[model samples]
Target: MRYLVDLGWLRSGLSFSFGEYFDPENTAFGVMRVCNDDLVAGGKGFGPHPHSDMEIVTVVLRGQVKHEDNLGNAEVTKEGQVQRMSAGSGIIHAEYNASESEELQFLQLWFMPRARGGAPSYETSSYEPSQMVNHLLPVVSHTGSEQVASINQDLTIYLSRLERGNELSFHQEAGRRVFLFVIEGELEVSGHVMETRDTARIQNEPHLQLAAKEDTKYMLIDLP
Candidate 1:
């Protein structure tokens, strides 16, 4: 019912002093695709690039990033903020550090478009850290449910922060997959211990069980 992907086994790419860890061909997990954890150095970032037919979401874990796009959306995304962009027909955007003294740590995720081609759009939202403590805070979801960032796929992403002795529960759908990424601290998911940067890919289970071995921060992605 569950499979694990150690962060060590994933490929890492370094560009502009940034580290990008990802899986491409191995990305398919029931409509949800691409999960990338990226850390960028202070003062350096991704140049404007074009993409089409993909839904991209960026979750900032620490520090700040300045974002500029063809949709005329420009702002600095700080810790606790989520940025959602739909590269429908085509769009160009650039993400860079907003400060020269701090590094930017975040996750860049991509989902295959439900259908092909449309007008591009962007949105950003700030979620409180206290809101995610010991619980799953929905960051992005299909249909823009509950005021969260909208995506093109039937998937939902929740960020969780748990302290030692804390645990979180998630009921599973019959034919979906759940991917858990430990962004900080240590956790035991269904008896399997995972440290920072570790990940778990799960499917077919009736529910997910997780307990913090210590203070922990993580993300749970539920996809159809």
Candidate 2:
């Protein structure tokens, strides 16, 4: 991952090439293009920016995010809240920290849509931390269910918090992909150890066994 410390306000660990970071060999993973672990100082953030034919999802880990767009959508998303914005044809938006005294930490993910050229849209889904205790809580999906935020891709995103010594497992059909990101603490996946902010990209693996070495918070994405 490429880490960027910018202007004393934004610090990011980017899993793929984005903004001023470029890596030809680490450009994208299947339909998932960008995964940025970002921490923004209070009262600071990205100014107005434009996007097109991309699906942007923000998972707020701490503090809050104040989001606004040209589509007349404005919302404050708190911790454990997942926000999705489809920049179908085109959209301009801004994201700022809602608290002036606390820093904001979030994961910014970008995915390529199956098809392009549609009206822009935005949505948010809230989840209780208790629901994620030792379980994979589906927070974003393509199913359009009321329980999760809908995305324009054939994928699902899960968030989980596992106590030390606990275990979790996931199974998917053959030929699928799994992307795992550790938000905090330590974990062991299929014999490989991962610490905080670590990422794993797995393919051709139908089943995964995860063991928490410490109280761990993580995000996993099942993708086509």
Candidate 3:
């Protein structure tokens, strides 16, 4: 997982095993695994890559990303858009910037699927920040009813674009884990001040409350 600190043509921060950073104990959080925050230089991006038995989700934070896959799904995902690709058996895909003069910033997440070896699939959607203001917008879920592509896990990704002075409260269930990733602005969680790209791994808590210190956009993973 990579999280960039500032806007730029190319930037990244890794949150898990990548390159020389390999901590076996810090590989994943529940079913949620890789979370990379990336900023791509215009006209540059990752080449074709292969993935298997994993759920790949991309959330565009700024600019646009061109996606092409073996499943014949090809499109440019703009800011506020989300794309999910299920590499059940296997799939090859590539991501590139959609503009020649503008940089692209995005978040890429990987989750462990409940079961393996099935046909791959792809889906995409968009969520405006205004719609998520001060509330949890249920984007990805195990069930497809929430408008996000269904994955093989009993979890949901809730996105919040909050305003200063507003708060978000959640009830934590037993045996469930919550992974919070701050995307923009600042938030106070469990006495910790989380800035952009900072994540909090929380579990065994009875309740949760996030107070926004500024207009904040973040993703909260409710995982079992």
The TM-score of candidate 1 is 0.87
Better of 1 and 3 by lDDT: 3
Model 1 lDDT at residue 1 = 17
**Compared with the true structure, what per-residue lDDT tens digits does model 3 show for residues 79-125?**
77788898999999999999988888888888999889988988888
After superposition, candidate 1 runs with Cα above 4 Å error: 1-25, 145-147
Clashing pairs in 1: none
Q: Total clashes, candidate 1?
A: 0
The C-alpha lDDT values of all candidates are 0.79, 0.92, 0.84
Residue by residue across 1-224, what tens digits does model 2's lDDT show? 55565768988898898878887888889999999999999999989999999999999989999999999999999887899999999999999999997999999999999789978999999888899999999999998677699999999999999999999989967878899999999999989999999999999878799999999999999998
Candidate 1: tens digits of C-alpha lDDT, residues 17-110: 1224233545456665666666677887879999889888889888898999988999998888899898999999998978787777778777
lDDT of 3 at 167: 88
Model 3, residue 81: C-alpha shift (Å): 1.3
Scored by lDDT, model 2 comes in at 0.92
Better of 1 and 3 by TM-score: 3
Using lDDT as the measure, name the better of candidate 1 and candidate 2. 2
| Residue 103 in candidate 1, Cα distance off native in Å | 0.7
